[model samples]
Target: MKIAVDAMGGDYAPEEVVLGAIEAVKSYSLDVVLVGDTNKIKEVLNRYGAKDNSHLSIVHASQVIDMGEHPAQAIRKKKDASIVVATQLVKDGACDAVVAPGSTGAAVTAALLGLGRIKGIERPCIATPIPSKKGITVLLDSGANANSKPKHLVEGAIMGSHYAKYILGVDKPTVGLLNIGEEASKGNELAQATYPLLEKLKTISFYGNVEGRDIPKGTVDVVVCDGFVGNVILKFGEGMAMFIIRLVKDTIKSSGFIAKLGALAVYPALRTLKKRLDFTEYGGAPLLGVDGSFIICHGSSKAKAIKNAIRVAGELAQQDVVGHIRKSIEEEEVEQYDSEN
Candidate 1:
């Protein structure tokens, strides 16, 4: 498979991006097209002794969408932006998938405008894999549409279910509506309206409403929520994880030498836990409902994160996630939005 990477999108652009692509090329049996300034990409490649490698190539994109710019407006104005060009490569079938470590808004806009949505999909959702006690739980509408309808949440469940089946390797993935209470009568109007719709779907394994604590507890394989709530939960989890880590360190320092020795004794286990908590290990989140494969990595991604993102991009392409989602939508006869506009 061939992957198009937005080499200029991340905090450590071109340099770290190129380094990660090179690592991916070496590790995986895939070709990579680095989309960015021709000279900068080539320099990074040459610096890392990855120059002139047949498995890697470059597509010169002159523009970049900065963090401060509006996503849709920048995409319309900057025709040669790295993220736009990379996404276009997927649309044009020049590459199997596109990986962008840029602003989430930019990535989503580029994908929507460049690739368009699959037939029967309204607003495309970001299906992010969150590590849980049992395993990985797929969280959809992670930040795509701030406000969504019951039908939209149902679509997310279908997409998230298929994702869990194919990518996460679950035999029968159970879905849960993210709400304040486990009962169908709880939550705001959106949750109450969405409950019956999800429970009625035979295509997916719906597990009724699940509270916020159930997310980390791994009560269900997939959690469905509108982008607004999902985004808040995602950010909160990230902050809480860091806070716990810092608290642990502070306590260790404040404790006596015996505590330090105990920490040293369990250093191997601590490193293992750290690896599990690292965001890079999960690669990037897949922007589902798009006609083509699109992976969005964190803006602060480095070599390891970028490398893993590329790996995920390739896997999604190879598995034909878009095709699966389209087929599921067709079979289910889900409602379609005015995609042309």
Candidate 2:
């Protein structure tokens, strides 16, 4: 499978991004098309002794969508931007998927405009995986649509379920709507109206509502909400993880010799904990409900994050996630129509 890499989309573009593509090519043995300024990309490749490799190729893109620029406007005007060209590669079937560690909005907008939404999908949402007690939990609408309707939540649930099941390897993954309380009637009008629709979905195991505290507790496999709330939860969780880790380290350092010894004893465990909390461990978030597979990495992503994002894109494409989502939505629609009639 051929994957297109956005060589000029992240904070460390064309350096870390190129190295990550090289690592992915060597590890996965897949063709990688690096889309960016060809000369700069080549320089990075040569610096890392990766130039003249058969598995790697470069496609020139003249412009770049700066992080500060407006996503929609940049996508429209900068047709040859790295992110736009990478997405177009997928739309034209020149690549199996597009992986970019760029501006999240630009990636999402480019995908929507270049590839379009999947059949029967109202809106595309970002499905991001968070580290949880049981291993990992999939959170959807993570900053994709700041404003969403009841139907949008229902779609997120369906798409998130498939992702949790196929990608996260959860059997019959239980989905929960992120809310103020566990009760069905506790949230806003959107959550209240979405509860029944989710309950009706036979494809997923709907577990009612999940509070913010339940996220780290691994209360469910998939958490569904509008992008506004989901994004807040995601950022808060990441910040909390960092805070706890730093707190532990500071406490150990400032304490007496006994505390230092204690910390030494738990150093291995702490290392494991760090890995669990690292955002790079989960790689990138997948833009679900879109026509083509797109993995949107963090803006500050390094080589490891980019490599894992490419791995994720490859896995989703192999699993035909978009196809499964379309089928699931179609089945639900049919069931709803028949029952109403």
Instruction: Report the C-alpha displacement of residue 152, candidate 1, in angstroms.
Output: 1.0
lDDT of 2 at 324: 94
Alpha-carbon RMSD to native, per candidate: 2.1, 2.5
Candidate lDDT (C-alpha), each: 0.90, 0.89
The all-Cα superposition gives candidate 1 an RMSD in Å to the true structure of 2.1
**Candidate topping TM-score:** 1
Cα error of candidate 1 at position 79, Å: 0.5
- Residue ranges of candidate 2 with Cα displaced over 4 Å: 265-268, 334-341
lDDT of 2 at 338: 25
Model 1: lDDT to the true structure = 0.90
Worst 10 residues of 2 by lDDT: 332-341
TM-score of each: 0.96, 0.96
lDDT of 2 by residue, 35-110 (tens): 9999999999999999988999999999999999999998999988999899899999999999988799999999
